[model samples]
Target: MNAPRTLRAALVYFNDFENCQRFMIDLRWPDGVVRCPTCGSDKVTYLADDKRWKCYAKHPRAKFSLKVGTVLEDSPIGLEKWLPAM
Candidate 1:
């Protein structure tokens, strides 16, 4: 659960999809609140099935994934593979 302390642990820790998601969430929103990257609205709902979030703030870009505003944004690569590499 704690951040990976070494390369081997990071490889294993980031291999799981859920772990990668949780890590990104914590890294981006340390306050434990997921916000809309576009509108910066706290009024967002997680779409678990799609692995994304939807903001209720009447905006064009209402849906986003954890990588939306990060350097990983728009990449086709999965977080499980990306996090460890980073």
Candidate 2:
């Protein structure tokens, strides 16, 4: 019944996870520490195809994306749409 509420919900639903991830990464690791999100270890490797980082330290979630351990978990959006939204 409320147009504004519906629009707000739609926007939230359309949030871009990749862009959110990159943004969060820049915010958290501006100097490009490339640390493991799960274990806080600087030992990490980038997986370009999957866009994720792998940690040398063994953990439940050794591999993680830029959005891992952030507010954008489980989102299915892209950076192209997310930058404008922000």
Candidate 3:
């Protein structure tokens, strides 16, 4: 009987929210143009204390997380767990 091949994957996951935030920031706004994800407004602000993005356009969804509008939406799991799963 041949045993099933169980592939072991070693994922280097980062638990630091800042690291994850920086990574997403780099991917979404590679040119340093941090626009509002909701309204596409370039006048967006970064709340380092809250670790989120705020849009100055006065929209319903002004404040957003790095996970907003992404595959991580509506997921309660933290980035540490999510990265490993990916």
TM-scores, all candidates, are: 0.91, 0.65, 0.74
Question: Each candidate: what lDDT?
Answer: 0.90, 0.66, 0.70
* Sliding window of 10 residues with minimal summed lDDT for model 3: 1-10
lDDT of 1 at 43: 94
lDDT of 3 by residue, 1-86 (tens): 12113323213424656556666677678885878888888888889888788998987989988788789979999765675565
Error of 1 at 78 (Å): 0.8
Evaluate residue 65 in candidate 2 and report its C-alpha lDDT on the 0 to 100 scale. 75
Which pairs clash (backbone N, Cα, C closer than 3 Å) in model 3? none
How big is the positional error of residue 41 in model 2, measured in Å on the Cα after superposition? Answer: 0.3
Report the number of clashing residue pairs per model. 0, 0, 0
Give candidate 2's TM-score: 0.65
**Residue 17 local lDDT, model 3:** 64
lDDT of 1 at 2: 95
Provide the lDDT at 39 for model 1.
85
Model 1 lDDT tens row, 1-86: 49898889999999998899889989999988999999899999999999999999997879999999888997899898888888
